[model samples]
Target: LEVATPAVRREAKKNRRLKIVGARGNNLKNVTAEIPLGTFTAVTGVSGGGKSTFLIETLFKAASRRIMGSREHPADHDRIEGLEFLDKVIDIDQSPIGRTPRSNPATYTGAFTPIRDWFAGLPESKARGYQPGRFSFNVKGGRCEACQGDGVIKIEMHFLPDVYVTCDVCHGKRYNRETLDVLFKGKSIADVLDMTVEEGVDFFAAVPGVRDKLETLKQVGLGYIHVGQQATTLSGGEAQRIKLAKELSRKATGKTLYILDEPTTGLHFHDVAKLLEVLHELVDQGNTVVVIEHNLEVIKTADWVLDLGPEGGDGGGELVASGTPEDIIREKRSYTGQFLRELLERRPGGKREAAE
Candidate 1:
């Protein structure tokens, strides 16, 4: 069970791996690995085991610098091959979509554009000569002047935190009285934003564009969240899911490489199941998904596993094992393999025994 040292050279396999050679970053002791292409790959190891340094700082950064023309400098590595196979690399992290309250799910997903168009086309809006711009809170035309379309007015408390009070003029509706009067089926745009994603899906069922985007949100297990919920209010996991939903709504290129760091964070068992379905759909469509995760459920489902380290910190950073879950389970040096062994054993019909 001796750890595998960094390989001097790696042979490229057609349509298989994006190979790395002589990867030396952070605590990584000249680690070399091959990441499978067009498959769900998991990079699992103990904390501080150089997983992030190798994958994110080195591999992803290098790929981004090449494909995206990013200014980021990758970590020290001899070379990386198979860049030609990938069209783009997307790092879908837990970063906030926006810092202000003005950014919401509808706006982030571009669903608001179509929704406003629909509202503008309504007989009430047409008769009133209201344009699509009139429904937007970002502009000044039809939004509440009292709170400046924020729905809440900020009261400065010199020593204490600023107090946010609901706009008395529009009662937190964000729109002016005249704008609110233009409604579709007795529900205004503000009312739609206030509804949960699940509710919005049902309300806009007939509208294909809006309903499809809302359905993507619900599919990602954000059904309970309000369409108008501020981006700042969302947790890291929630923000990541929102981004995922936005990507899902678009047509797949089938050549995109999606890198997610611990996507299972803050997700419940049922939520994880929904996430897997979405991720697998991406892989099935000819896209690649690479996730850095410790969650065994996620690890077990991966088509390929790149397990780094027999330990953490200074004692680790070597490639402990690599390949399919079945292959990794046979490696003595991989702690991840030991856990996967238990999972494989518990599967119905005792599939592990037959695989042996």
Candidate 2:
């Protein structure tokens, strides 16, 4: 698809592309597309334009099917005609939040276990005859017996949405009255959750793993988040970054493919920089990062662009153009090409930036 642009296409060697052939699903009518990996790449198209269908449901799903290969699966599930190549595709999509104010980052990141163990295994803990499970809300031995460790009391509203009132016993802190009595350097679990990542960094400075994990969250533009904050309270972008941080912490490496859908959807213009850094870091670690994006900033940063449409809906699906920002602008048939060209033409000296 990028045959027209020699300069942009030359970087082809750097990519580990998800090659497709006759991948029939959704609006993609007998479509064949090539998505380059590693370098920041953007797949742009109008809404309902088959962008999600191709990238998320079809290509990424097929790749994952290969990973979860089991005996009970459907025959055609993993097989994609012409889609012969790729290591693994991670669909970094935002999912139903772990609601229930009881759920917090410490629990979600699996950091709470070791932390509780640290305290439980302490000499003081042995003197007090306390076990690590006692610190956990999920366990029987140590949770608040009243609300069962949930920070709130569920008020089943008959004619309205169910409301939650802060647990009168624990007062919005999931810990039981006794658990709350325990302190880690003077901060309670509720206090920790209340403290944003910015605050937690300093608060947990003495701690090892939790502090580092919180630092990663901060680096991913989640400085405003608190370790104890409920997952239900997080914004989409915040949750996405948190999820990204969880993956990044693994020091992920080798031919892995990351397929994210509009990762910058709710982010501010400046916030894109954090995501770009995350993507580039993945590439540096020898992995592939592919994003279905409408944001031009991401599109421009891409080493390759697999722009999907001439138009959206019924008129879409064809691979109108694919290449760098420069090559696309010169392609007459590509709507994105014309759209971008118009923006440049309207700007001073054709110097319009993606953030604009």
Candidate 3:
């Protein structure tokens, strides 16, 4: 079983609802709510429904205070005004970046370090291989001297906005020809990086260490993701999964309190399942995952649901319903309950609704 540290356990033991009385933050109604710990909690509402304001302005604020020493416990006690219950909150939000010629996925999750070191440890490396440091594009030695290992170059566009073109000398390979000649199982470093996570999974399945992590990326609907794809080039959703992969790699000790904001932003219908697996793993490890999501599939999986909208704008912040998916569906007043009910009705013969 994944175990949280004694301190985390103690804090969780004291876990209770977050009380917001007369919250002055944006779009936040005089909200009074309680968010339970240990179980997966999904915060749901319509657009501009104070979801962001509540999670970021309140829970995240409390956690930040504790971490930065800007605030301390025992201020307003526990009923409201941000409490000590939320100590670990990681907010993953949207970012604008698709792909960058100079960047790739390796630099984001920190997986590149060990892989480079692994090659450096090879017998060939000891005989003729350069040090791990030298193999890095960030350094010299085996790097592409012409492009400085970035594989691309920035071009100044005269009489127009600045632009960049692929490096002419390196041909966007980002490695010297000699280094490209070194083969790991008949695949060059550039060749391996050029492969997507799906292809890389089969290619490196027997390589050990790196394979399992790469597989997770593939299962998460990132099969098209290149090993060397720059993070700066990734969509927000892709970057979140990369972050999830790193999070799952940690030894499960339930004390972690991860906060994810609309993690399903860019996913297609099929891709969400893969994301769910990652979240389930974290919860099974004993950590508390709090997500701000509008997706029905996510809220349906919740052990307990916290719906915070009677309506948006000045109407939200008051708790409309809090219970299981079944219970919420029974409540005529719940907005999410009504929407989910419609989904249930559309299915033939009252068939059960599927998780998104």
Candidate 4:
């Protein structure tokens, strides 16, 4: 639903509540949600149970208009409170960071600039008067002229889709021979980019700027991804984590509010565990994280839960329960709680009688 400029209520408490009053948009039956600040909160339910409607359409949009001064009109809601507690609102989604192959993790996370500067400072580059610009594949001079720094040549066909083959000149290196000649520890700029996040971490261990950024990427469960892997080749979950890593690498302002929708999409069980650790780290640093989640593993570990359905569509949108996972399991009317009950009870040491 939608809300206008909400009135701010200053409180002396640390953990304040972000209350949504009268959210009646879509099938949300006048739902009023109270999300606490500085904690991990999950909005959980079956599909089409108004999770997006409550979090994105109403909360995020209203916050955007009020905080960032965006032109977005929130879904139907009366007012939102506790916005004064937040300085920033980031919706981390699966949308590509950049649509072109030219964009990669290093560039997106601000690691590429330092990497280029490091290369330019090498003795070989100094002898040739090569600058950071020379190390960049995006510019002229040092890039392979054949591919225009793309490393691949696109060929369009009349009836078939265009084809992209590695540039024969540089052999997908994207740089000229002379540029590649200047190396740090026997690896060219192209070679460094070709390394995975884990490899980059070890290669740049002495360089704080580059190492820290790559370390964050690894911390977010992306150790296997190439440092300069094209953004276009990333999955939605990968893209989302890349965005998260970029944010994490920045100086954290404890007041920022992060909203994510189904961040566990396409993630393996182990990866989900790693992703949760990173997310909890954000909250531990005193930031608030709200996720639109259906994953039981994620929801059960949340500090607070807002289960939004007794059922989906016309049968849902009302708040079935709002509490910790233990509290949710006691909710007989909640379908989520029933499943959660099984999960909680089936835990290694959980009591079988407690599940009933």
**Compared with the true structure, what per-residue lDDT tens digits does model 1 show for residues 243-354?**
9999888898877889999998887788887787788677766788899999887777777889988789998888888987888999998889998898777654311110
Off by over 4 Å in 2: 1-15, 70-87, 341-356
Q: Tell me the tens digit of each residue's lDDT in model 2 across 1-356.
A: 11111123225444345667765565666677676554557788788777877777677666666764522222222345433445456777776347676676767666666667766765556777888877788877666667887777788989998887777776777676566566777766557667887887887687877778777778787787777777777777777777787777776655677888999887876678777777767766766678888776566556677778677788887777777767788888877776666544443332212210
Winner on TM-score between 1 and 3 is: 1
lDDT of candidate 4 over 154-220, digit per residue (tens) = 8889799777788999998999999989889989999998999999999999999999999999999
lDDT scores in order = 0.85, 0.68, 0.67, 0.86
Tell me each candidate's TM-score.
0.92, 0.85, 0.82, 0.92
lDDT string for model 3 (21-40, tens) is 55445656566666556667
lDDT of 3 at 65: 68
Candidate 4, clashing residue pairs?
A: 1-75, 1-76, 2-74, 2-75, 2-76, 2-77
Number of colliding residue pairs in each model:
0, 3, 10, 6
Off by over 4 Å in 1: 1-14, 155-163, 349-356
Candidate 2 — what's its lDDT?
0.68
Query: At residue 354, what lDDT does model 4 achieve?
Result: 10
